[model samples]
Target: MRHAYTVETVRAAERTLMSRLPPGTLMQRAAAGLAAACGSLMHGTYSRRVVVLAGSGDNGGDALYAAARLARRGAGVTAVLLTPDKAHPGGLAALRRAGGRTLPPEPEAADQAIAQAHLILDGIVGIGGRGGLRPQAAHLARTARESRATVVAVDLPSGIDPDTGETPGETVHADATVTFGSYKPGLLIDPAAEHVGALRLIDIGLGPYLPPPELEALQHADVAALLPTPVGETDKYRRGVVGVVAGSERYPGAAVLAVGGALRGGAGAVRYVGPGAEAVIARYPETLVTSGPPSKAGRVQAWVVGPGLGDDRAARQAVAEVLGSDVPVLVDADALRLADRDQIRRRTAATVLTPHAGEAAALLSADRADVESARLAHVKQLAEAYQATVLLKGSTTLIAQRGHPVRVNPTGTAWLSTAGSGDVLSGLTGSLLAAGLTARDAASVGAYLHGLAGRETPVPFGAHELADRIPQVWRSVHPRT
Candidate 1:
């Protein structure tokens, strides 16, 4: 798993590590990594035009010192000080000693220097920064964006919520970010994740001092370790059966897509109970179809409720019956509305709720825009409210549950935003639940695999094709040995 520590935790770790070392040893270590990355970006040190947007803090010191290294190697480096009087004194002196020049934050001077530069290093703000940039800095950041230069953020992109990844105001868009020590929450979550184009993590040795991660993203090995594989004695009955309650007269395709995902997502058998029985049977003849409530759907290890289920009496009854069952349940799409909160919180078995921003907004009684802006906060809130696992799917798919690190899925393509794609995800996650993975693991692993399948599927493909690619991606992760 790739761990993301909160700003407070990271700051604490940095402080602890710095105390053990000499006064400037930690800063020098960070500068060394930043300089190496800047050198590589320029491709060659000689005659390279490098610009550093230096502020007044350690972040600025790191970038300025890095620029000094390039200046020593024959690069013509310039520093555009946002606050000329408050800029890091040591960093400024080092740059001057190495033959680099400095410029005030004048539009004409900075504009000309930035336009001619091959690379720009952003050191305007550090991890504790919130709200947005000051007027002058924001304008300079805009100009930097307009430049042809490759912008590299020293730690994270300035003017972003380092913990929440929310952009309250104008923020610099970095082509690449060289983060030191540990990964910050903003570096992995979206809005800010969008600002951070490509990412590079440079270790300055904070591992021993760091605590538990605030958020995590699963890698292939982590998912593979949690995969439920069949043994020599395992049969179809022993693998696990998933019960799917989805689709309606209005959206029969939801049933077909969900069933497709279940079969391909490692479920031994699928017991489908819904109004789209005929449609599901036509698409997946192997599905065990029944026209009864989920309670009478003949013994399933877990249940996936909702998708295209409308707000009808039958749908409510189905939701209630599923919620009443002893097995774990995954609620999605229309079912998020139909399922009762009290009933969910009362359940002993695990409950996973998957909601897109709009649905999550409805559930939390907040604006869709707010949910989208601070996805990290909203996801955790919903998990606490429901007392169940919550998966907030959007630009970044996040899984949140109490007492565990929030999980952010890193393998998604924007193309996966098409309609019915989430139905496939619901089924896949439900199957993992039946396979006996914890609610957090099921949701995280499901999002991981589903995102990979989205990338694996060809462009302009439908949800059906995305589901079809699941088994292919599954083999890629847990290959036959």
Candidate 2:
């Protein structure tokens, strides 16, 4: 699992580590790591030209010191100081002592150096800075960006709000970022994440002081452990059954897609009940389809509702029945928008609400922009408010349950944005729930599989292609025994 700490957590850890060590100890460790990363970028081209964009903070100190190291190793290094007078005094002295030259604040000089450089180190700001680059720094950064040089950010791309993962103003676009200690939230989430090209972590020994992370991503091995596997003594009924309530006359394809997803999922049996039974039967004759409501349908370990059920009275009735049942419920699509919070909270069975940005905004009575800006906090809040697990879908999908750390899904691609994708996800997740995975586990595993399936399909895929590739994803993640 890849854990991401909030800015406050990282600050606290830095303080604790700083208190125990001597002054300048952490900075030196950071600079050393930075220098080593820069050397690797040189790639046997020690005679390459390097430009260091220095600011007034510890971030600039790291770049200046790193440039000194490069200069000593025969690279022609030049530091373009945005705030020359306020620059780290020790770093400036060290760079000069190591034969690195410094240039005053001149746009022409900065432009010339950047154009001729092989690499540019952005030290204009750190995690502490906010609201993008200052005007002067922004100009220099733009010039560097236009150059052919590979830009390396010192800690984070300057001008990005590290905690919120939003780019507030002008920021440098990095070819790669060398972060200290651990991964920051900005580097993992989108908008700001897009600016951070490739990422590399340089350990500075701050792990002991860190607390539990606010969010985590399940790796391949982590997914391997959570997947459901049948034992020798287990029969179909012993494994688990998933009940699906989806589709209507207006959109019978929703039922077909939902059943398609469940059939390929790791469920023992799928009991599908809805008005689209004929359509579902036509596509998947093996499905045990019923025309009655979910409550009247035979017993099932879990229920998935609202894939294609429109705002019709029958769809609402099906949703109400699923809420009243004693089995876990996975809510998605139109059902998500029509759900009653009070009824959802009153349910005894485990409930999972999966909503995209617009749906989540409707649930919270807030705008989509607000939800996107504070995604982590909103997902957690929804989980607590409705007393159900909340999976907020986006580029960086987040799954949070009451009293548990939020898990972010990192495996999705832009190609997964096609129609009926959510229905497939609902079926897969509901199947996992029926197979006895916890609400959180079911959501994360489902997302991982859905993303892997989307990746397996060629880009620009239709929903059917995404559904067809689920079996391949399952095999890749969990080999049959």
Candidate 3:
């Protein structure tokens, strides 16, 4: 798993570790790793001119010290000080000793240095940086970007909220980023993640001091462990049955797509109850299709409701019947709007709500832009409001429930934004719920598999085509013996 720590936690860990070490030992350790990563990127094939964009914090000091190492190895190194007065005294002196020169943030000289360099180290702003860059620094940063040199950020890209991944202003778009101590939430999420090209982490031995992660992204092994595998004695009913309440005559494909996802999601059988029964059976003959309320859909281990479900009176009744049932429920698409918050809040069984930004905005009574920019805050808010596990799907898929650290899905592809994808995801997740995983586990695993399938599918593929790729990815994650 990829764990991301909050800025406060990282700083606390650093402070505790720094207390036990010599004054400059931690900085030197960080510098050594940063320099080595820079050297690897260089590959000995350039004019060997390197420019360091240094701010006033230890982050800039790290860059300056690393540049000194490069200078000693014959790279032409120059530092552009954003705040000369507050620069680390030892770092400034060390660079000079190693035959490195300094330049002011004046446009002509700094931009010239940036233009001729093969690499630019972005230490202008690091962790805790917010808002846009200062005019002089922004000017130099623009020039560096305009240049062909590879830009590498220290810790994280400047002008981004390190803990939230929010880009409040113009940011440094780096070709790569080197982070120290541990990964930050900003590095794993978007807006900020978009600016980070390639990420590298260097351990300064702060592991033992850190607390539980603020966020985590599931890896292949983690997903493998969470997947449900059937034993030889298991029968169709013994494995699990997922009930899908989706689609309408106007949107019957939603039912077909939802049933497809459930069938592929390790369920023993699929029980589909909605207006799309004819369309579903035509496409999926194995499904036990019904044309009534969800209560009479037979003994289903879980229920998935709301995809393409129209706002007709019957559709509302179907949503009410399913929510009133005593079983795990996945509420998606149109159901999200129809399901009462009080019903969701009072349910003893697990409830999972999957909503995109627009859906979430409706639930929260907020602007879509606000939800998009503040995903973490909004996801948590929605989760608490409904008292259910919430999966906010987008560029980054986040699973949130009250008192649990959010799970940031790393496998999502922008291509997965196509139509009817949410319906498929709802069915797949509901099947997992019937398989007996907790609300959080089921949602996390379902999203994990869904994202992997999206990434593996050919671009421009239809929603059904993406669902078709689920078993392929499932096998890849936990391959057959």
Which 10-residue window in model 1 sums to the lowest lDDT? 258-267
Which candidate leads in TM-score?
Answer: 1
Name the 10 consecutive residues with the lowest summed lDDT in model 2.
Answer: 37-46
Task: Report, for every candidate in turn, its global Cα lDDT versus the true structure.
Answer: 0.92, 0.87, 0.90
CA lDDT, candidate 3, residue 395: 89
Question: Which model, 1 or 2, shows the larger lDDT?
Answer: 1
Model 1 deviation from native, Cα RMSD in Å: 1.0
Judge candidate 3 at residue 218 and give its lDDT.
Answer: 92
Q: In model 2, where do residues sit more than 4 Å from their true spots? A: 479-481
Decoy 2 TM-score against native? 0.95
Report the C-alpha displacement of residue 335, candidate 2, in angstroms.
0.5
**Per-residue C-alpha lDDT of model 3 across residues 208-263, encoded as one tens digit per residue:** 99998989889999989988899999898987999999999999999999998898
Q: For model 3, how many clashes?
A: 0
Give each model a TM-score: 0.98, 0.95, 0.97
Candidate 2 per-residue lDDT over residues 1-481, each given as its tens digit: 8877888999899999999999988888888888888888878437889999999988999899888888888889999999889999988998999889999869998899999999999998888998888889999889988999999999899888787688878999999999998888888776678788888888898999888887778988899899888899988877789999998888888888888888777789999998888888888898888997787779899999999889977888888888888989999988987777899999988999999988999888889998887787788888988999988888778899977778888788888888888888899899999999999999999999999998889878888777789888888887763
TM-score, predicted candidate 1 vs. hidden true structure: 0.98
